[model samples]
Each structure stands twice: as C-alpha cells, then as structure tokens.
Target: MKINFTHKLKILHPFFYVVALCFLSTKAEEDNTDLRFATQPTHQTAVLGSTVVLPCRVIPRDGTVQWTRDGFGLGTIRRLDGFDRYSMIGSNEEGDFSLKISPVTLEDDSEYQCQVSSKKGPKLRSRVARLTVFVPPESPSISPSPEVSATAGVNVTIKCESIGGRPAPELSLRFL
Candidate 1:
C-alpha cells in the first residue's frame, strides 16, 4: 500500500489553521482586559484613633474608578458608609486613589476591594486590600505605688497596670 503526498498535505492543512485561529482569539481577549489595580502598604495595619492610607494604582485609564470596602460600594473614601473614621487622602488621574482612615478602631479591620471600570465591558479591574487594626500595647504602669522596696532575696510584688488592650503583659521579675 502507498499514500498520496497531496492527500496527506490536505489532511494536515486544516488542523494547523485551526490551531492558529485559536491562539489569535485568546490574545485578543487578554488585551481587551488589561486594566489592573495594585496597592501600597499591602498589609494595612494601624492603631486605634490613628490614620492609615490605602493606596490604589491602576494601568491604562479608560473610564472612572471607584473605591469600595470589602466589596461594598464606596463612592469615595471620604463619603463611604460606616466611614466615620475614614476619608480620602489622595487621588489623581494617574490611577492613584488612596483611602485614608482617621481615628481607626479595632472594629475597622476587614478585607477591602478597589474597583476600576471602563465604558467598554471588557475593561473592569478590581484589587483587594486587607486592613488590620491593632491596638498598640498601653504604657506599662506600676501598681501598689510606682516604686517598690525589697530586701535581699526577699519576695516582693511589683505590679504593672494596663488598659484598653489585649495580650496580657509578661511580668518579668528583675531587681534594679
């Protein structure tokens, strides 16, 4: 048995063409959705009653951009709901919309999302920013009086007081 050269070429031509078409289609789809977002201070951590900035940067501007809190619609950081302690710190045409939170509290720690959209449906980009509010350890205080007197090798109690915080302080016994 023998195979015809012309018949073999015809069989392979269609398969090769189909592969090329698929590659082009995928590339086009990716190009259309190139807008993306990123953040600075990737991990947002701050103390209560302190201000924090949530920076947002994007690539290629084609439409308006908006800020959100954990996926909820936040027209602007300054005007966001449940944002009494938050505000807009900075915004520019260069895709920089940073959120500012003033007098932050422990209740404000949560996941946040920033969304960017264009007139064309193909240009919708979003980025997530995680906020962590930590209450700094309070200034240690000495109880039962600020100073304690003890004899050599004698048991003495030096108590330190703290409030509005967590993680009980580790009492270290040291003689000075």
Candidate 2:
C-alpha cells in the first residue's frame, strides 16, 4: 500500500517544528553566557571615618546590580534607605556596580556581595567580600607614671596598656 505524500508531510511537520524549537532554545541559552561578572568585589579594610568602595562589574552590562550586607539586600543600584553613608558608584552603562560608603563607621563592617539579576539567566552572585573597620586606640598609659629610680644593675617591671581599640593594639616599649 502507498501512503499519500501530503499525509506523510503533515505527520513530519510537527516533528520538524519541535526539533527546530529545541535548537533555537539551546542557542538562546548559549548567547546568555556573556552575561557574567567581569570583576568581583574583594576583601577590604577601611579606617573609621573614611571612605571605601567594593568593586563589581558585569561583562555584558545588561541587568540590575544590587548590594547585600551579611546576606541581606541593601538596595538596587542606589543608596540604601536608612543608611546615609551607603551609595552606589560607577556607571551602570559600564557594568560597574561598586558600593561606596563614605565616612565608614564601625557598624559598616560586614560581609558584602554583589548580585546581578537579568532576563537572560538565573541571578548571579559574586564571591563574598569582608569589610573591616579599624578603630584607633586611646592614649596609652604606663605604670610608674612620675618616675622609677632603681639601684645599679637592678631589674624593674613596667606595664603599658591601651584601651578601646578594635582588633587590639600592639604595644611596644622603648627605654630612654
């Protein structure tokens, strides 16, 4: 028995359509590979009352970039609410989404990450970057304030202490 040519064509039409769609979908996914982070924020240290920037950049430069502190969202491409010192720097056209904090404070110390949300693929997150805020210690005090007199060849003990410094301050003594 011979099948009609039109009937054969009709039956294969849907199969060809499905295969073409699958190929196109795969190509679309491959095109999205360009959407990636070009620069990831790195660990940094900032002194109190100073400014700092956490750098982040995307390759394709198409998407919304946001800053997160300790895993919580700060805002999307703008200054975060209730945080006067926090703001976004760098141009969005250039894919720079660096987070800037002016007059850094002790409370600004935390783990930060840059996040990108695009229509091409799943959300992208940069490696975690830690910010350390250094606080200067107060004036150091030494024991035997006025004077310490000792006989020749005699040993004396003196103590030095500094208060209110983060990460603890190192102490060194010099004899006059």
Candidate 3:
C-alpha cells in the first residue's frame, strides 16, 4: 500500500500541531516556575508608634503579591482597606511588595509572610517573619522614699522597679 503525499501531510499535521502546542505550554510553565521570591521578608523590631517595613521581592515580576498577617490575607492592593496604618511600599514594577506599617502598635506584633501567586504556577510563600513591637518603660521608682540614711559600716538595700515595658527593661543602680 502506498500513501499519497497530501494524505501523509494531512495525517501528520495534527501531530505537528499537538507537538507545538505542548512545547509552547511547557515553555510557559518553565517561565512560571522561574517566578520566585528574590528577597524574602525578615524579622523586624519596631518601637511603639513608629514605622516598619517588611521587605519582599519577586523575580520575573509575573505574579501577584500579597501580604498575610498571622495567616490572614491582607489583600493584594497597595494599601489595605480598613487598615489605616498598613500599606505596601516599594515599586511594583521592580517586584518589590514590601509591607509597610506606620505608627506600629502592639497589635501589629505578629507573624507575617509574603505570598506570590502566578497564573501557571503554584502559590509561593516566604518564610514567616515576626514583628516585635517594643514599648518603653514607665518612670522607674526607687524604694526608701527618695532618701535613706544608714549608720556607718551598715548595709542598706534599695529596690528599683519599672513597669509596663515590653521585653522587660534592664535596670541598673548607680550610687551618687
């Protein structure tokens, strides 16, 4: 049996089309796989009523980035709604989706992550980064009511204490 050229071409046309489609699809998948976090957010320490930035950057810039706090989504927009202090900093063109919190409060202390989702790839999440907010201690107080007198060659004990401080305040005593 001999097959004509036109018939052979017709039979192979579908196979060639399928092969090309698969190749293109694979290329697209490879490109999506390249989408990754170039810079991940790191642990941050911020003072109460201050501002802080959690850095995050993705390469290839082909995906949507969002910030999550304690596993809760904060949306993918530049500024989060209902959150006056929460916003996204850095340039979107550069793939920097850093989260910024102005006037950080004690409530802002929590774990945060940068998440990236692409059309053709699985969602990517950065390592958890903790935000620690420090609150200054109140005025320290000394026992003995401002003045204490002791006889010569006698030992006197004084106590100093500070209240309402995060991470606890270190206390040191100096004698004048």
Candidate 4:
C-alpha cells in the first residue's frame, strides 16, 4: 500500500504540529529562566587606601549567601550600617552581593569569590576584584643634554625612579 504526500500529511499533521508546539514553548520558557551570577570582576584599577565597592549580584534564585576573600569567610552577621575598613554591604535576597573595601592596602590585593547556597546545590560563584596600591614615583631630574644638542643617531639616557611604598613602585616612560 502506497500513501500519497497529501494523504500522509493529513494523518501526521496534527501530531507533528503538537510536537513542534511543545518544543517551541519549552525552549521559550527555558530562555526566560534567570541567569546564574557569573563571577566577573569589574574593578580594574584602584589606588591604595581608597574605598572601593565590588558587586557580586546573583540573578538566579538562591537560599544562603556569603562573601569570601581568597576562600575566606566575610562573616554572616549583617553589618551594613557599621563603619569599618572592610564591610559587607547590601542584601542577599536582593541579589546585591557586593563587598566594600576602605583604605585598601597591599595585603588586600587578591581575588575574592562570592558564593550562594541553595537547597538545589551550593554554587561557588566567584569574582576576582583586585586592589592596586599606587604610589607616585619620586621627582625626576633631566640632565641638560650636555651641549643642549644631540644628533638623532646619538644615545641619550633618561632615568625615572620611585624609592618609596611597601611594594617597590612601578615606573613608566614616554618620550615627548
């Protein structure tokens, strides 16, 4: 027995339509689900001893929440109103998992991870926020190019130095 195209389609159209509908609806619903907070440090540059707020917000629903520095706990006690060099501000439910650091030092320079726990599972979400302590270099002096004139092929020495700070400072040079 041979079934023509129109006849076969007539028999299978309803089932095929139902399956397509289910697949489309499920895909759309899955796309609507909240995205889990992926740890991505937004802080790129910071001066030593300056206050900085690092955000660790979570988009997906979660239960327990905690902030950690290099896997170290930041305390569960709510202390948003309290004034301190380092403080955990904002709420977990609100998805604002940010850590406030004040008067940051060289020791504070490290990666921090924000983790949220739930009945489903404990998700170790991490964000690496770096604290850079910048100390200005010492006053630079320019030796009057001897005769005040040097050929392009001639060699000239320019020196810049910074003699202070807990970590030896970094130096950069630019020829005008």
Candidate 1 has its poorest 10 consecutive residues by lDDT at 166-175
Task: Note the Cα lDDT for every prediction shown.
Answer: 0.67, 0.88, 0.90, 0.65
Q: What TM-score does each of the candidates earn?
A: 0.65, 0.80, 0.80, 0.55
lDDT of 4: 0.65
Worst 10 residues of 2 by lDDT: 143-152
Model 4 alpha-carbon drift over 4 Å, by segment:
1-35, 38-40, 80-83, 91-93, 141-160, 165-176
The lDDT, on a scale of 0 to 1, for candidate 2 is 0.88
lDDT of 1 by residue, 79-156 (tens): 566666665555566667667777787766877766666655554545566888777677777867777877889987
Q: For model 4, how does the per-residue alpha-carbon lDDT over 78-147 read when each residue is reduced to its tens digit?
A: 4633335767666656667677788777677777666776545545466566655565546544455323
TM-score of 2: 0.80
Highest TM-score: which candidate?
A: 2
lDDT of 2 by residue, 94-163 (tens): 8888899999999989999999887678889999999999999998998887366777899988888999
- Cα deviation in Å at residue 121, candidate 4? 2.1
TM-score of 4: 0.55
